[model samples]
Target: MEFAFNEEQLMIQDSAARFLAQVSDSQAVRTAMARPEGYDPALWQRIGEELYWPALMIPERFGGLGLGFVELAILLEQSGRHLLCAPLFATTCLATPALLLASNPAVQDQWLDAIASGATATLAFAGTPGLEADNVQAVAEPTGNGYRLNGQYLQVIDGAQAQLLIVAARSPGSQGDTGISLFAVPADSPGITRHTLPTLDQTRRLARIELNDVIAGSAQLLTDAGQAWPLLRDVLLIAAIGLAAEQTGGAQQTLDLTLAYIGERHQFGRAIASFQAIKHRCADLMQQLECARSAAWYAACVAQERLDPTGDVGVASELLEAAATAQIHASEAFFTCAAESIQLHGGVGFTWEYDPHLYFKRARASEQLLGSPALHRERLAAQLLGETL
Candidate 1:
C-alpha cells in the first residue's frame, strides 16, 4: 500500500498550515488565550468559512464535506503547530463523533448539523483518568415526557464555549452496562452549571460541569438505554487518532524551531548548528518525528476505512500502537527540542516573551489529553498478551 499523501491530502495540509501561519500567529494565539472564554470568535469563523475543518468530520448527507478523519488530522496538526486556541478540537473531534455514533437519527440531525457547521460542543465521558468504572454516582431518571439528569463531568475541554454537550450517564435501577445511556444536553438547560478551571494548557480551556435534576426530552437521547458501547468505542478511537495527530504536529514544530534557531545562533565564534553535539541531537529528534508521522498516517488511513469489525480490530491494534508510541516519542522530542531550542537561542528562549515556550507548553499539555504515554504502554502490553486493557 502507498504511504505517501495524495494531492488532495497535501493540498489540505498546505491550506491548513498557511491558514494557521496567517491567522493563528503567536500574537493572535496569545491574545485569544488571554480572553475570558479562551477562543477567538472571528478567527474561528474565518477558518470555518474558508477551510470547513469542523464539517470535515461529518458525512455528506448531514451537510458536511465528508473528507474523513485524515483531512481533519491534517488540520489538527496545523492547529497544534500554531497552538491555535479554539473549540474546534472539542466540537469537531469529540462532539461530531459522539453525535454520529449516537443511534438516534433525529438527535443526530439536530446536533451533528450544528457541530458540523462550527457550533461548539463538548463531550463528557465517564472513563477519563481518575474516573472509576462501575461508578454510578451520576444517573438519569425517566421523567414526564423526558428525563432528569444529575451528574458531574470534570476535565471537559472547552466546556464553557460549548453550546451543546453529549453526556454519558447511567439510568437508575438498571444493572450491568444495560443501564448506561447517552444524552444531548443544551448548554442553557436549567440546573446546568459550568465552571471553567485553569489548566496547564492555556491554549485549551477546561470546565467542570454539574447537572442537577435537569430535565431532557426523549428527543435528546443519543441511543436506546444501554447498547451505546459500540458507538462510544468508535468515538474514543477517533479521539485517540486526533490526539495523536496533534501530538505529531507539535513534535514537528518543535524540531523545526530548534533547527532554525541553532542555524542562526552562534557559540564560540561558530554557528551552533555546525557543532557535532547539536547535529546529532537534531538528527535524533528528526528520527523520532518521522516515526510519529508514520504512525499517525497509518492510524488516519484506518479511520478513513468504515471501521468494520475486522477492520476495527486491526485499526484498534494499530491505532493503539500508533497513538501510544507517537505520544511517547513526540513527548520526548518536544521536550528535548524545546529545551535545545532554548539553549541555542541562549537567554531569549528562557524568557516568557519567546515563542518557543508556547510550543513547549502546548506539547506538554497535549500529551495527556487522550490518555498518557504510560497508559498506552500498558494497553499495548495487554494487547500483546492476548488480553484487552
Candidate 2:
C-alpha cells in the first residue's frame, strides 16, 4: 500500500522540526541532561501549552485536539531527531496509550484531561531485564477494597518527576499473563520511593521505583487480574509504532548530518564525500532510512485506522505484525546509521563535544526501550508459526 503524509500531518511535522531545532540544540540538550530533571520546564510548558502536543492524540471529549496516533508519532519523531531531553515520550507514547488501552472509561476520563492540560505521567513496567515470562517480579496482594503492591520496578522513564504513574504488576496466586494487572498510582504515594539511575543516554532519565506495601485504591486499578493481557498488548503494539517512528527520524537526522559533514570535510584536496567508500556508506544509510520510514509510517497509518470502537480482528493482528516490523527495522536502522555517522566523521565524532555520540547513545538505548529486535523477532515468528510461545 502507498504511504505518504497528508498536508496537515506534514505541517505538524515541519512545525515540530522547527520548534525542536530551535529549543533542542546539542548544547541545550547536554545542559538539560546534566540537570536532575533532565529537561527544561519552560520548554516543556511551551510544548504543552503553546504547541498543545500532550493533548494531540487524546479524544475531544477529554479536552484534547482529538487527533490520532499519527500526529503524536510525528511530534515524537521530531523530538527524537533533536535528541530532546523531555518527558514527552513517557507521557505521550507510554502513559497515554496505557490508559487508552485499558478499556476503562472512568479512568480515561479521570486522567486524559489532566494529561491534556500539561500534567506529566509515566509508565512503570519491566520488572526485570529479561524478555522471558519469568522476568516479571512485582506482586500485588488484595487489601481493603484495593491492592497493596510490593516489588522493585527498575528504570521507569521520568519516574522522579511524573505526577502520575501507570504501573503494571502481577497479583498474588497466579503465573504467566493471567495474574497481571494495571494500576494508576500517584507519584507521591507514601510507600513508593524513587532513585534516578545513571544511564548512557543522559537525555532520557530513568528511575528505579521501589514499592513497599504501596497501596493502590480501587480507583487506581485499571485492569483486574488476568484481564490485562489484551489491553497491555495493544498498548505495547502502539508504543512500538511510536518508538519506531522516533527511530526513523533519528536515523534520518544522523544521515543528513553525516552527508553535510562529509561534503564539507576535505581530504586529498577534495571533499571526503567524493570518495567512493563514503558515497557507498551514504547510499546504504539512505536505503536504511527509506525502509525505516516506510515501516514506521505504514504502521502508524494502520494504528490510526484501527482507532474505531469496533475493530476488525484480522486488521488488529495486522497492526501487531506491522508494529513489530517497524520496531525491528527502525531500531536497527538508527543504530547502524549512527555508527556509520560516527565513522564518517573520524575521531571527533567519538568525543563528548561532538553531537554524533549523543545520537549514538540514544540509538543504543532505544534498541531495548520496549523490546529488543530478538524479542520482536519472536513475535514475528509466532505470527508466522500461528502459535504463541
Alpha carbon lDDT of each predicted model: 0.76, 0.85
lDDT of 1 at 109: 87
Q: lDDT tens string, model 2, 35-109?
A: 879999998998899999999988889999989988888988898899888889889978998877666678889
Q: Which residue pairs in candidate 1 have backbone atoms (N, alpha carbon, C) closer than 3 angstroms, thus clashing?
A: none
Clashing pairs in 2: 178-226
TM-score for predicted model 1 compared with the true structure: 0.92
Residue by residue across 1-389, what tens digits does model 1's lDDT show? 46877899999989888878988888998899999999889888876776788888787778888677778888888887878888988887778877866768999888778776778888886633532234334688887788889988878888878999888777777654566777898899899898999887798998988888989887888888766655665576677777778877777877787777788888899998999987887888788778777777777777665343233554544655555565566556666666666776778887878888887777677667766667777866776788955
Q: Please give the range of 10 consecutive residues that has the lowest summed lDDT in model 1.
A: 127-136
Stretches of model 1 off by over 4 angstroms after superposition: 131-137, 173-178, 306-322
Give candidate 2's TM-score. Answer: 0.96
| TM-score for each of the candidates | 0.92, 0.96
lDDT for 35 in candidate 2 is: 83
